[model samples]
Target: MEVKVASPSASRRSSQTKKLVGGKRGCHVVVKVFPCKICFRPFTNGTSAHLHARTHLNSAELEKTSLFHAKCPHCQKMFFVHHHLTDHLFVHLSREERAEVAQGWRHGCYFCTKRFRVSSHLNLHLLTHTKEKLGGICHVCRKTFTSKQNLTRHGFAHLSEDEKIALVKQGRSRKCLFCQKKFPDNRAYHVHLVSHTKEKPFRCDHCGALFGLKYNLNKHKLIHSEDPRPFKCDKCDQAFSQKHHMTSHKRTVHRKLKDFACPVCGKKFGRKSHMVGHLRSVHAKIRHPSPHCGKTFTQKGHLGIHLRKLHPSEPSAK
Candidate 1:
């Protein structure tokens, strides 16, 4: 946890030192004598040396260290902050080198290279990656936790009613028989149970839409605002409130980039969903077949869409 603080005299002392030839190959013949105290890597000035010291802040042996912050794929050097790593690539790496390895950079996000100053902010950002598909629910129990710590201690959720009540009296657990989901407090337990009942107390005032989560309701309310669409397409006049939607628009429309292509057919699609839909409709046989006819569809929703279009007289499919 203990860190060595850089003294004010570092910069002054660096200025007094004479330039010398570096030991590393391809290094400048006459480089600034100032070097990192720990690694002895040559730098132009002491300020850079001090900044470079942050790279050493992260280590498996250190108690105050963070997750692998910023790793250089080239020399295997690490930087403690993303901005510092960015500066390293721009200043130390050649233009062609940066372009060659730019895609290798890793971040907390699986889909994008977005970086955050705080680890907690990064943790929050990661939830977005799962929320769209899984609705923030844990794949293990098919339930979501308000806090990350709760998910770790989820085995307690399976306790019997008597044991759960006893734990609640001991100020430890909040569980019920219905969903078998545990909470840290009585308030959270009550909220979790309400979701099971499909109450959806949080209602949007603008469109009269109900939502189970208050945060979801708040997000829905933004659509009715004067300037709800904050994220705008740089190339086009179209805009969207969410950053992901805007990014999808750019990829599908402006960029016309396709990451996935069908092996059976040479057809391509920008979005993974589109590619999947194409595969299920064109190539793969359907699992859901109509009882009335031999017609088949990849999804129940797709079948329902067909029914509405072809058989307008027929009632809506449940």
Candidate 2:
């Protein structure tokens, strides 16, 4: 899945650049910003990101030299790294549940259910827990938030309450007629308008990917670099190109602790297809019948899959 596109000479890139940047700086590509998946810390290169990732894993991870794979019970997502999986598991638990785990596993590792004999051994295990201390207080408004990003976003509201105003006036009255979203100025208003249309003007010179926004296209171009995956799950030797992808890989594949449940008959399954099959038998009736063959299917997706596989030239549905 690696796609390579030429430099500024490409058609998509030149067209996207003019529509996006709309200025003399259209030729320049977006700057690279590498953020750590675990802590959201930004770094310039993969070596630093890889080095920092080692901090998230316990020393025990190294002693055991074997392949490791973790799967989230709820969504059936898979993760390659142990510490990433452990760090992801907390998001699925409520505050009370998390506190319970922290207390109960205080003398043990909650993620792997591994108990330690010594107090210092348990203390070392705490480093693997990635969830930050929950209560973050805002300096200006004295407001509380769950994470640093929320606090930072909340702080923007108080940027200029009364005393001074920004030189470039924000037209709060300037609203998008189509979506009812407020915009600060004409430039922003026009940018918002692009989302309504099927047009994606922003372009990446390296890969020639199209994006509606310059910000997103610029962010996408970073993937073309030699070392796109700065963040590394050193525990499992897995590398992630994007920080969010790594976080999501951990959260969805590792932290989830329960199999997916069928709403109709209260059946649980590790795979989604199995649950769907359960629904087809108990709740849904076999309605979709094949024209050529005598076989019938309970769902359109199943029938479509059958058609694509067996009858390659036939239309999927009647």
Candidate 3:
């Protein structure tokens, strides 16, 4: 028989058929074969060829072309990854120019100097900073919130004006005996009482840790499990399991913005919760009245101390 060699396409098809029969399946099986420009290695898939071509590039060329072959939308600069392209886009502007642009375009949190992609997200994040009880009170349930936005959200659970009138006519009121607070329903009343009783109904399976809220229990379970931390900081070596932690780190450590200020003492805090805690401890004057004697203090802990020292005969609440 005369010696013969098959055409490139025919040889590729033959190889593909052999691979299919051997139970080897991939993108290279269907696509037109191409050789890498740098190494001249045969690759049926373009993406594989592109990736293989990168191995031949030096460090400088790799850095220059690295962004997964993505082109920047703003300056048309090429980068290896999407984030690299985004970072490079900022390099086109000066510090003053960037600051001026940020004034108009950036949606940033006042407490930690964290910037958000959207205004709604920024508004939602701002709620985390207001640790003090909000003045907005729900007329239907007498429930207070830290913000009018939260009050509006709580109002959705209550009956409408017509429904309220009908309930009044029926002489039905859902009220708690312990706190004398009204609720939308009996279920809401019972749920409210759980807070005062400090009930931990939700129990974790992996760890016997109990949480009052089901969501808090779920969040706690993440600590016990081996979860992947996909969100990584591009500016530093640090990586966080949660996006909020990453955002917080960027704000407090990188931006160094202390937006939360105590209303009574005028002390600045990086977080709203810290400011609220300081106010409660130093200024709130929340005194637990002694059942035996009329004694008051700033903190519940102090009341406990007084009870232990002066009124040792009386039993403590906890």
Candidate 4:
């Protein structure tokens, strides 16, 4: 063994094997390793690694350049080139459905129960439910979604804490006019205003029930479909289809945590909506006057009660 000497080829092969096994132990032995700074892909030479790293840098630059291009005025979808964007405008023009396909179209499908920006996009998305090839797949859940937008939204659930925080910060530049509340985006601010107006645009087709939020409409539809209640109460046998309902039940019934306190009456409410309703009934200005006695009340219920008790034969003033 003392007289034996390894050949140059054997020494080179050993070094190659060590470089191939680029773990902590092997990396310590390989002194001349040309590891890529971007992806850490090990290379035989520094020049090769540097060239490979430049490809990633070029891709990042291309993405930045693409973002600098003009976006569609209607859909706000970005275009890498002006000609491609001009061609996209024709799709919006010369159509009866053009009015509905405006900036905040929010096209929804009845079949897959998914929402989209444009009706034509929704039509194309519907084909995915019937065909396998067009289906959008989520890598994290391994589930198939009808549209890419739905899949993107599904991906948000898998985001890291830092990524989620950054995304929240990106959208939080806008503020609400009524409460001066800060929202992440304009869409969120509009949705929040629905609470103040008490406007219920999302309606259930099955039961003819109405909901202010699309999420609530989706949850309400589950009732007609007889979906299983996954979220259960720990103290009682009660279960709910939605997690927020379970949380609400727990806070109101079990925990009894009245977090939302009424500013006018000093009354505590388990939910913010309940507190808002209380404020509207007790503290809000009397807009609807009682035609029976020229008296005004904050709530419609109070006016109805006053009419029924005092002016029963007055034929119920409108």
Report lDDT (CA) for all predictions: 0.58, 0.53, 0.58, 0.59
lDDT of 1 by residue, 30-95 (tens): 434555543345567778886775443323224554444554443233455576566545434443
Best by TM-score: 1
Candidate 2 local lDDT, residue 317? 41
TM-scores, all models, native as reference: 0.35, 0.30, 0.29, 0.33
lDDT of 4 by residue, 168-238 (tens): 45542334434655544434545676675454545566666767677877777776665568788999999
**Position 120, candidate 2: lDDT:** 60
Better of 1 and 2 by lDDT: 1
Tens-place lDDT digits, model 3, residues 30-128: 334554432234566778867876653334455673335554443232344565456446544544666776666578888985676568778777867
Worst 10 residues of 1 by lDDT: 1-10
**What's the count of clashing pairs in each model shown?**
0, 5, 6, 1
* Alpha carbon deviation, residue 188, candidate 1 (Å): 16
Residue 252's C-alpha lDDT in candidate 3? 71
Q: Give the TM-score of candidate 4.
A: 0.33
lDDT of 4 at 64: 67
In model 3, where do residues sit more than 4 Å from their true spots? 1-192, 196-211, 228-243, 265-267, 280-318
The reply for model 4, stretches above 4 Å from the true place, is 1-172, 175-184, 190-217, 227-232, 237-241, 263-267, 277-288, 293-296, 301-318
Model 2, CA-based lDDT: 0.53
Off-target runs (Cα >4 Å) in candidate 2 are 1-196, 213-219, 228-230, 256-305, 315-318
